[model samples]
Target: MTDISLEETIRSFNNTGYPFPEDKTIHSLFEEQVERTPHHIAAMFRGASLTYRELNEKANSLAYLLREKGVRPDVIVGILLERSLEMIVGIFAILKAGGAYLPISPAYPVQRVQHLLRESAAPILLTQTQLISRFSIDPDEAEVIPIDLNGPVYTYPTLNLQPVNSPHDLVYVIYTSGSTGKPKGVGVEHYSLVNRLNWMQRKYPISLTDTILQKTPYFFDVSVWEMFWWSIVGARVSFLIPGGERFPQAIIETVQTHSVTVMHFVPSMMSVFLEYLRNSQSDIQRMSTLRQVFASGEKLTVANVRAFYDVLFIQNKTQLANLYGPTEATVDVTYYDCPMDDSLLHTIDKIPIGKPIDNTQMYILGENGELLPVGETGELYIGGVGVARGYLNNPQLTSERFILFNPQGLFLQKPPLDPAKTPDNNPPLTESFKGVQGGVFQKAHLLYKTGDLARWLDNGNIEYLGRQDFQVKIHGLRIELGEIESVLSRHPLVRDCAVIVKQFSQNITLIVGYIVPKAENVSSGELKEYLKNLLPEYMVPNMFVIMENFPLTPSGKVDRNALPDPSGLFGTKK
Candidate 1:
């Protein structure tokens, strides 16, 4: 029987809840850090560096300017800018002015951008002068704030109002690509951000002398942690451009040029990086400063992890780690410090995503909500301070997932306060529902149903199996198959689409999309380019297989299994 309350567990684990710090908001943290370390370099992108003092003044200037135009907290302000210091400042400015920042990647389609703007009801949008024409929005219908980092600016706000709340306030909302349907906004509060950053700082201890590569897009949750973390400690943040088709090379050049000591990448990006490394004919040791490499957004395969350790980190001893968590869980819940063991190489099909950080608790349970014995597989449930406050404006989805949890074991409570009421506590349920006859009492358990399947090993480490539904994790990002189909359905060349995850190797999962073209002559390469403009490079299907029609299941839904295997078109690993 678990004795810990959810609230108690969070407190003990040092998880920060919303509305924290009592007096400061997310913007205030940036402002305070900037003021204290004015001369330090805060951001670096393509040979450009902005000092703390400069970043603060620029952000404040934009904030003042935006507020003058009636922008305020709770207002959704869209940001569609390239990865640069100005983009960083634009985000801070929005937050400082009490508005939530909504980042729309230019890589997405104009219609997709417009759809997000409409869904968010964002009244104001900040854009780069170069990409203004990409938006399908009418400027007259909304407030458009244009910032030419190299050009002139008219107004900069000078307000010094004390922030109304603390770090627990809503910091931003990042819309993830929905495989099940349209993109859903993931709300991350200031409290969760602070807690995550604090945990990272303590664990990695990145400092002013350290240089970290900000490879992920600013809109990605990983980027949020990356930008602020380096700023807080006076370290340097090197932003990479949206590499388009040349993403692998972009990552390589950044690491080589910046002498980046720390970096984060999704598995897809990492695979590309490794592929580039193998083909470049350059000395592997050229990546010397990369002291640590972390991969998430998909399962870290044994082969991939082993290759990285052998080829990239062999000479450098760069510590490689696998991080796992959901967006609703604030970036990461658990981590596995990868080991360089040749004997266990083949056994690396699934890496233990380590234990919960600080105050998080994870459970592996059987189908009926009972803890499975060691070496048994079951659904995984996580309870921690890292859990988000459910999805934004998604109450029904939230209710279904975030359920009421009682940790004192199951009970059939009798009528209120009856003196003779029997104790409500029921017998502690085991894997087989066998009542404990003589064992000592254990922590009372309150179970949460995670749709994921996992197994507890003899070593007490849990190994993730796979999803119980059609949900897929591509390059570490959760995607719903149905969501991809919805997006493809709207494409000009696509009449219909069926997306599936093809496991080519134990470590490699590819999103192979089969499309029924509106025009039979539509080429795969052409459709691929079309998608690049609408989705992130990672979400774009690796193999686009055109089909005449989708096979139907007996139940009338698209028969996913009946679709021809894509490995024939795209070569498999063994």
Candidate 2:
């Protein structure tokens, strides 16, 4: 935007309204699907399965009890359970009772669990009796309600109780990784979650026969869509056993046995799965039944894109989509479809996380809230029906992340809403952004500052460049770890890789590359020589550490914090 005149660049989004169901609740849409396919198998875990009618009735029975316990709109109910039929039932029951369900993993440390519970201030916890020992719960903390403990639940009437909940009420408050403290609770409203799910259904519509594998843990936001996306479309859900999400062989067998059509992955785990496909012929053939493979949570590498075609995608029409978003802006806001042709991949080495979802507005803005031009890297800001209300119980932190801004390109267009009719206490626009004529926005609208660095491509797609906070400054040179990792992942011998900065001495910081070799290990000198030809000398890692595997989080993301110390490792320092 370097002092460029606003009149020169084309101003888009002049008309940004869609025919989305503005008033429908998530369960309301699911009810419609239930009417369409009541006899269809709605969920499957192990040998047990539930039809649409049976699931709704069971959820309604539990919902009756939740409402009796004073569950209402915006009420957070703690849910801790392993992957089972009851887990899905509890989620629906909480939502049907007009309460926002908060997921707590059974594998979480007791201290972290206590912290989340304390921060959330939940009054009720849904869990199994056997798992009650896992939580170090104080008597006054939360009233534990095990699904099986209530023997009369099946005898209770199975009817959809009319809840006093509106679309603006909170449906789920998911926790995400945060700095300065423990994980932050991102409270997403029913409207935001419904819009993302509806838009996804429209773009990539799932059929009644399609089976979506629910492998992602409920703690992460990606599981939000994985759980509900199919429920609305009347698609069957095949639940993966607890902790089996990281195993590629297990995924293949699940897909083959259940005829799973749709699934998702974080790019790190996707890379691992694709390599496993290449090594085994039976696994690759079994994975051929997949209709779609979704990648998100981290940057999708070019190598991962190419490997999809070489193995799993060669025999089938399974489309691979890349999704990008944070917990604050719902599960996902931007999506990309990987092209199948080699000629298409030749022109673009980096695949773009293509355009905003329906009725959503995405802007790449520079410092001071001014809009950055194409090809210039800047912070990504999301504004639309998809943006969440704000962080729960953290006003100062929420205000810092969610902001009001008037982009240079959109300043001339009509505001999303009326300025005089608004009633919020947020400050009225008083200042103008630089290099714009009257860049003040009279109307107050909230936008989530993702803190993610991205740039707009020539085709109106966005190229995600990692997190702004994750960028490391070494010797006055700011470096993007994703760029280094992307280049390192391109090497022929590397199976999977990650680049992290380690501080050893007061003045000495080293860039460390941790890699899982394909078959045989390669020496550090050879890897350094390969990186030298592709990357700048400063961007190359100071040391390369070969490893058997990269440790992953419960949600299947590479846990960089758990990487072992690189001291005394085999490598050369520049």
State the lDDT at 117 in candidate 2.
Answer: 77
Tell me the alpha-carbon RMSD of every candidate.
9.1, 11.8
Count of clashing residue pairs in every prediction? 25, 0
- Which one is best on lDDT? 2
Estimated TM-score for each candidate: 0.80, 0.77
Stretches of candidate 1 off by over 4 Å are 1-24, 157-161, 244-249, 275-283, 341-349, 407-450, 458-460, 487-497, 503-557, 566-574
Kindly give the stretch of ten consecutive residues in candidate 1 with the minimal lDDT sum.
425-434
**lDDT tens readout by residue for model 1, 1-574:** 2533423432332232121132346567667777678899888888888888877777778887777676676667889998877788888888887778888887777767877787878888888888887776876656666776776763554444345444445778888756446787877666566657766776778888788887777777877777777877778888876552246666767777877889887766677677667654474566778888887777777877877776776667788888877776778777778887767776656677665664356667667766555557778876544556556677777666665454443331111222343435211222111221222221112223557887756554567787888787766666777776777788887888888889898547788889988888888788777777666666777888888889999999889889998777656569
Worst ten in a row by lDDT for model 2: 426-435
TM-score for predicted model 1 compared with the true structure: 0.80
